[model samples]
Target: MPASGQTAERNSHLKAVGFLIGGISSFQIGATVAKGLFPLFGPTGMVGLRVGLAALILLAIWRPTRSGITVQSLKLLLPYGASMAVMNFCFYVALTRLPLGIVVALEFTGPLTLALAGSRRWLDLCWALFVVLGLYLLLRPETMAAGTMHSFDLFGVAAALLSGCGWIVYILTGTRIGRMFDAGHATTLGMTTAGVLLLPWLIPVIPTAIMHPWQGGMAISVAVLSSAVPYILDMLAMRRLSPRDLGILLSMEPMLGAISGLILLHEALSVARWIGVLCIVIASAGNVLTRQKAIAH
Candidate 1:
């Protein structure tokens, strides 16, 4: 390639990276904001608020028509949205009890595993070991002063893992949906469907949250920063980058969550716990890089 072409390509890649980083930062900040509202709406209620408002925003922006709607489309869209609903619920549930960074680190294992699946590379084994070490570090009992012991809530840990499973389902179904429909239309409908699915549980929560206009504004903010902006930026970045690059970029979320929590929520992690998060980050990034390498060979 010529010098000018190389420079343009480098600039393009840099722009996409910036988009991905901004999306992740927005998402972490949104998570911190949601955490602050737990006293008002609670976890499930907050998830309802976030998804409901996000659905509306997405619908407004995409303006997706029902011209091509069919039962066949609903088939994939339903499961995709269901996965998102479950994932969001579980994630919030876990977040209520665990540190934001820990919840994110656990939830990230799903994509790490998904990326590592069907790989035969030796380096992939090392990534798996990194995951194991990370998990151990995250879960192991750390002793505190004054005869205290520090540990994560088992139920919260379980919820985070379950959230990971939901993410796996979301990725699998989302890929299929993207292939079958317009990405914007599919995302708009998927988010809306997720909101509808959550309504069964959020019936009371939604009405209660709506009564206070102030709470409604907060919910809208969460929706815009967390769901709408991140999703839009992700779509844009994904178009310009490969899946592996996307995966690598996403591995930074645990750190982002940790930093956001410390700054906005005043949540802090122990030194070992920080290392545990780093291990997971490395594993997540390594898994993606190895997958790319395997594909090349």
Candidate 2:
């Protein structure tokens, strides 16, 4: 490529990296905001509002059409949408009882597992070991028994595990959908489907919950910050950057979530837990870098 072309490409790559960072930051901040509203809306109500409003906003913005969709596409989208709904619902439920950082770390296992499953490289195995060690440290029995331990809910942990399973489904299905439709169109449709799936649970609480204007504002904020902005940014970044680069950027999410939880909600991790989080971050970055190197070879 010519000098000018090379310079333009470098600039585009930097722009994508910036978008990815901004998107993840927005997501973590939105999560913190949602946690603060737990007393008013509860997990189910909050998930409902987040997904429902997000669907509306994306649909409005994207205005996706079904004109070119096939029966097979619809089949794929149905499960994809359901996965998204279950993932969000279970994640929020876990958040009600767990710290935001812990929940995010646990949820990340799904993608990490998927990455491991697809690679046989010895270096990948090493990264897997690091992840396992990190998880063990994060969830060790001694830590829970310590005087500093917050009340831990076993059910919340289980919900987080289930959310991880749902996340695996989301990742696999989303990859397929990305090939079939424009990002905005696919996301809009999938989100609408998720909102529809959650309606039965959401309808019951709407009548009894005391809805305040400030709460409504917060809900909209969550939709914008968490769903709309992140998805759009990811889409833009994907256009300019390799998936390997995107994966590396995304691996920082757990650390960011931990910091955001501490700053916004005053949820602090123990020293041991912080070490575990650092391990996971290192493992994730290592895995992505190793994969990229392997692909180049």
Candidate 3:
């Protein structure tokens, strides 16, 4: 590539990076706001309300056509939407039991694993250890007063871990969908599919949302911030960033979530979790900084 082309490519990567950062910040803020609403909506109900409203909002903005409504699209959209639905449901379920930051940190392992899989480099191996250490600190928190270790909510931990698996599917299928359709349209349809998948749960949610207009307003705020904005930004970013790059960049979310939880929700992290997140953040950064050599292949 010529100097001008290289400059343009670099510019594109920078813009994509900005989009991802914005998406992460918006998502954490939205998660904090949604956490406040969980008391009224419950975790499952919140997932329904969020996906439903986000689908509706995105549909209104980006109208879809019937041209690409082939079996092929359905095959991709189904898994994409299903994983998204599962990811959000499990995430909120874990959020109900865990701090927002902790849930995010644990859930991040899915993408991190996907990104870092099959690496042969010594640096990658070292970075992988940092990730493992972070997870260890997360899973094995400080000891209690009685000399026994503090045990986390097992269900929440499992849910968070499962959500990470769903995240892997969501990222892979979502990127494919972005390539096949307009990113905005793909996001709209994908959210709609997720909403449909969770339609049963929306039964109770719809009534409560109607009865409490204030809660409905808050749900809408969440829909815009969490699903609508972030999904679009993420899909756009995926167009430019390889999955490895995406994973490395997204690894920052745990740290960002911790900050958001602290400042907005007044949730304080344990010293162990803070150190864990710091290690993961360091690992994530190392991968990105050393990515240039990997690109040599």
Per-candidate TM vs. native? 0.94, 0.93, 0.88
Sort by lDDT, best first: what order? Answer: 3, 1, 2
Candidate 2, RMSD to the unseen true structure: 2.1
Candidate order (TM-score)? 1, 2, 3
Report the C-alpha lDDT of model 1 over 1-297, residue by residue, as the tens digit. Answer: 999999998999888999999999989989988988888889988998899889989888889887888888789888899999989999999998999989999999887888788878889889989888989988998888877887889999999999999999999999888887888998889999999999866677777776888987887899899998898888778878888898888899988888888888888898888898999999988878877887799
Using TM-score as the measure, the top candidate is: 1
Cα error, residue 178 of model 3, in Å, equals 2.3
The lDDT, on a scale of 0 to 1, for candidate 1 is 0.88
CA lDDT of each prediction against the hidden true structure: 0.88, 0.87, 0.88
Sequence-dependent TM-score of model 2:
0.93
Residues 1-297 of candidate 3: C-alpha lDDT, one tens digit per residue: 999999999999999999999999999999988999999999899989999999999889998987888888899999999999999999999998888888898888787778678888899898899999998887785777799877679999999999999999998998889888987888888889999999988878888999999999999999999988887798779889876688678768999988998999888878888999888888877887677657876
Clashing pairs in 3: none
Deviation in Å, model 2, residue 155 alpha carbon: 1.4
**Which regions of candidate 2 deviate over 4 angstroms?**
1-5, 143-151, 207-210
